[model samples]
Target: MHQDTVEKIEHALEGWPLLDSLPRECYGFHYRALCVPIDDRYDIFSYENAVIHKSVTAYYHEETHEYKLRMQVGFVEFCRIEYITNSLEIFGEKLSKELMQLLEDMVTFNPKNISSLVIKKGICDWAFAKELPETLEGYQLFIKPQQPVKINNGSYIIIDYVDFTHASDVTIYYNMYRDEFFGEARIHSIPDVTYDFDSNELVELQEKLEKHLVPRMREARQAADAAAHEGEA
Candidate 1:
């Protein structure tokens, strides 16, 4: 990228605190002709935090003297919004405004903001409705889960639960006989413990897992270890 273009981007991004606060290593620039190597065609700026990842890229078309700016924001491995514009000013201003709003929403999000139907549908079709619980979870649940897999008499969908400090995978399933929603931690070698919930208890189950699952798993593991030591003795 030319010095002039760099200056324009810096000016456009002025007053954007989120991007500005990112370390210098997160910023990258590539300069080459449109026909050159595929990797050197655009200048990219990217940043990733616990909850979201954001990126902005600029591609200049020499033939038309036009600049294409692409901005994207989303949770890691989940839902995202991509905005492309030819105006550098719009790219900077729009992305900054939208990001600020997103940050505000994150702080104020709650499960009550979403409908019960939406929650049920999101869990049933997690591959498609990954963003429905962002408010309740306070982070982007972008990690794609496998399609619902059939078991003996029911089906289950697994989705990722991630935060700044933990990654606890969860499986949501339906019991054909019981007609209930069941959730369990996807831990290895742990005793089987499944919580049954109704559609209304969906958010409550998530809250329980987020707050207590880890500690519960720890206690279970300790008990198992003690039992094993006794057997050895």
Candidate 2:
């Protein structure tokens, strides 16, 4: 890979992952996963593959008020086969307004440290699909959390979809296991998600549904169009 290209890529990252090793599948593609540090951080990326290959969704525990960046990578055949946590919010000292803005990529942060990048396996979670996407669509969702889990991913449910066909909500179930800092998954609106595409790019109907998407869906549902609920997957 060209040093200049890597430098330019790093220049955009707020902070990169602590990579443990080059991913086995990174054989012929120019792909990267960046763990940025905005107030609500995300795992932003650019890839030759344009499907919803991987994604993340985060939730803050109000009682603790700490942030959790849930990480999920996708396989063509499976929904959430693997996951990892990037950072825990350290409400350390309040960052300067300038710094906070910088974190959100409102302003650029020097990615000169990009080449020194890494992808460490932080907290890891493995959830197998007990129910098929087609069948898990009823308001009833049952996921068997890992027994030795270190993080409470989410039992305090937040729903972004309320009206799609039972089959339409299956992707959301898979995205449930994705970590938020790696990449964002939202319900697609203009066009519904496609199954033949990669998971990363597969869903474009709506995305990052937790924040604005869910609220938008609620507002749209009042008009009797539950279609707003489908988002980035």
Candidate 3:
């Protein structure tokens, strides 16, 4: 990417909002779990056994009484599971930034040591429109069609937006049934490209988000709102 291109991306990303941290007394946590099976020694292992015999990584802050931990043992060295907390008690502070740091370090540190990678986060039992708004505000963050699949309860859809070469496309999952929306980005392998890895990664993300996702979201929200108003009139 050229310097001008890099500058453009950086400027656009600023338009997107940074996610807020979950309140200290959040109903529950939204976390990201990564799976990297460095070795396949524990093939065909029983799930029950793995649960019983788990490995744990924990961190505690005595001063603030902040405790964070994750427990899981590699099944015959077949899988290395780790979690980066999205929302937790970190001395009344949000752990998003810290979590992101951990993710970048772990993945890049030993890309070859891992076999598979997964990133997932959610707010369980969410309440729809009342809590999670349909309006998506940003430059070009939403996808077109804005279709939601109707279900027994309400509706939900996952929008695949943002491209980062080798990694999975960034996603925005919306659930009307649950009245919740989750945004997630995951990478299995680093892309072989030109721009600066450190500076350009987030910039690229912002560019795609602004270029594609935001506009679609705004359009959907407007249509939905208009329909609601027309029904009332």
Which structure among the candidates has the greatest lDDT? 1
My TM-score estimates for the predictions, one after another, are 0.30, 0.23, 0.20
As for model 3, its CA RMSD to the true structure in angstroms is 22.5
Q: What is the lDDT of candidate 1?
A: 0.41
RMSD of each: 14.0, 17.2, 22.5
Misplaced by over 4 Å in model 1 are 1-120, 124-146, 157-172, 176-179, 184-191, 194-201
lDDT by residue (67-184, candidate 1, tens digit) is: 4443332311211224445665565566566644443343344344333443454554443344436423322343333233223334333343333223323344544445445655
Task: Estimate candidate 1's RMSD in Å.
Answer: 14.0
Q: Which residue runs of candidate 3 sit more than 4 Å off their true CA positions?
A: 1-116, 119-206
- Which residue pairs show collisions in model 3? 42-76, 128-179, 140-210, 140-213, 140-214, 140-215, 141-213, 141-214, 142-213, 142-214
* Candidate closest to the true structure, highest TM-score: 1
Model 3 scores a TM of 0.20
Whole-model lDDT, candidate 2?
0.27
